[model samples]
Target: MERALKRYWPIFILPTLLAFLIGFIVPFVQGLYLSFCQFTTVNNAKWVGLSNYIKVFKDTTFTDAMKFTIAFTVVSVILINVLGFAIALALTRKLAGTNIFRTVFFMPNLIGGIVLGYIWQILINCVLSIVGEPLLALNTQAGYWGMIILTCWQQIGYMMIIYIAGLQNIPDDLIEAAQIDGASSWTTLWRIKLPMVMPSITICMFLSLTNGFKLFDQNLALTAGEPYHSTEMLAYNIYNTFYARAGAQWKGIGQAKAVIFCIIVVAISMIQLKATRSKEVQQ
Candidate 1:
């Protein structure tokens, strides 16, 4: 069986490799090239060198979006992981109706991002109407918090599930041993459970970080970066630059922003993974 599998591995891998080259690698290379050229379409690309990047750096809207996205990612990553881990801890404690609770909590994650955005927008607007605020679109602070709340609500449950799996995988003997050693519950959790769950933490943090960075549909549907574009995030900013602007130069600038976005995300994700993985203990 091992011999058969090894012999046929390349045959099975070839299609996927080809598809990846066609779907991702090709477009990625092309996008990198287009970032240095001005063009309305791929066929008409004209080399403009680093002027696109220069424009990207000079654009105040892009700078604001970059700052906004970083802030949002930082806040969301902290909230989602802390809340998700707390909920996972609670649900794993043999509480009554835990299955039902899990299902209820996780159901929000199944909803589409666009749908969740619209739903929250209506709910938030209804509440704000009582106080005579215009709407989420008109209040930058409110829109910022609304996006944070919506992201946390949608993501926490999914992260909780991952934490639960990590919690469950912990050996009963180790926990019992800690108890036998007169360790308090807090001590046991800090010394044993958390270290054991570091793998889950890594995964959750990576997901949350990347999701926060790449978020667009929710940003679009929720606030649409209203109130003079104060709430626009990097992804939405790039998108608007690509399609909403009048001239061909904007496309190259947008592509440059995308490349920068990709680099930031990848670099941050790699650093996070390395930091978390170092803390993880072998079972």
Candidate 2:
């Protein structure tokens, strides 16, 4: 079996390799090249050096989007992880209808982001209407909180599933041993349960962080960066630059913004993984 598999490895791999090159590698390289060129379309792109990047930084809207995006991502990441972990802890006990409870909680995550955005907008506006305002009223600060609340409500359950799996993977013998040693629940939680769940924490953090940064549909559907682009995030900012405006040499500038956004997200994810990994302990 080993010899046969080894001999046929390339046959199994070739199709996937070809698809990857055609689908991703080529397009990715093409995108990088286009970032330095000015064009309305792929075929008409003209080299424009660093001007697109300069414009990106020069736009105050872009800067505001960056700040807003970073702030939202930070807050959302914390809330999602904490709430997810807390729910995981509760659901781990011997409760009736645990599966049903999990399904109910996780249903929100299965909903489309755009749908969730509108659903939340209607609900929030219904309450805010009493104050003579609506979801997109006032400024980005209001939109920022609305976005955070929407994110937490939608994502916490998904992360909760991850934490639940981590909790279940922990051995009962370890908890019994800790209890026998006169360790209290707080000590056991801080020392044993948390360490055992570090893997789940790492995964949840990465997902929430990346998703927070890349959130577009919800932001678009909910606010569309209304009130003078005050609520615009990085993704929406890029989209507005790419399609909403005309005769602005959209393609290259959008591509450049995308490339920079990718680099920033990758670097931040790497740093977060490194920082969190250092504190993780083996069970």
Candidate 3:
């Protein structure tokens, strides 16, 4: 098998390489090019250089979206990772019906973003109706909190499974050694368990961070950045720039925004990966 893989590596790689060129690399290069040009179609792109980028910064709505997105991401990442790790700790205990609880928790993650959005919207509205106002009308604070709750609820379960796997992989010998040293539970968790699970922590953090930054479907279906567009995030802002308004100018600007977003997300993920990878302990 090893000899076959080595001898026929090109054959195995070629199909996927071609598919990547077609599906990703080609479009990625084109999209970056489109960011600097103004056109209704790719073929007709007329180079406008930095004008779109300038417009992106000039738009206060885009700025607001950036702020909202960052705040949402911070809140969501904390809640998702902390709650997930806690649940993982709970489930890792040899408890009855643990499997059933895990299944119930993770089931929310499998639901479509749009469906979850509507469900949450209905639930929030039901509560808000008692006070005689809609969810969006309640203000930016409500929208912000709502989105955070929605994100955390959906993401925690998935993250929990990752943490659970990480916890289980910590060798029993290490725990016994720590116990022999007269370490308390908190001490062991902070010094031993956490260090051992750094890989899992990195994965969970990256997943939560990236997902928070790139979130769109739920943002769209839940708030749609409504009530004077107070809740607009980066993705929805880009969408509105391209399609909601009249003119090709915003389309080019949207492309520029998207390219910027891509750079931001990629750069952050890389930095986080590097930072966490350094701390990961060997088994």
**Candidate 2 residue lDDT tens string, 167-240:** 99999999999999999999999989999889888999999999999999999988889878888999999999
Error of 2 at 166 (Å): 0.4
Where in model 1 is the C-alpha error above 4 Å? none
Q: Candidate 1: lDDT of 259?
A: 98
* Leading candidate by lDDT: 1
Flag the better candidate by TM-score, 1 or 2: 1
Lowest summed-lDDT stretch of 10 residues in model 1? Answer: 133-142
lDDT of model number 1:
0.96
Best-fitting candidate, scored by TM-score: 1
**On lDDT, who's better, 2 or 3?**
3
lDDT of 1 by residue, 178-253 (tens): 9999999999999999999999999999999999999999999999999888999999999999999999999999
Going through the candidates in the order shown, the clash numbers are 0, 0, 0
Best-to-worst order by TM-score is 1, 3, 2
After superposing candidate 2 on the true structure, give the runs of residues whose Cα lies further than 4 Å from its correct spot: none
Local distance difference test scores for all models: 0.96, 0.90, 0.91
Measured with C-alpha atoms, the lDDT of residue 139 in candidate 1 is: 96
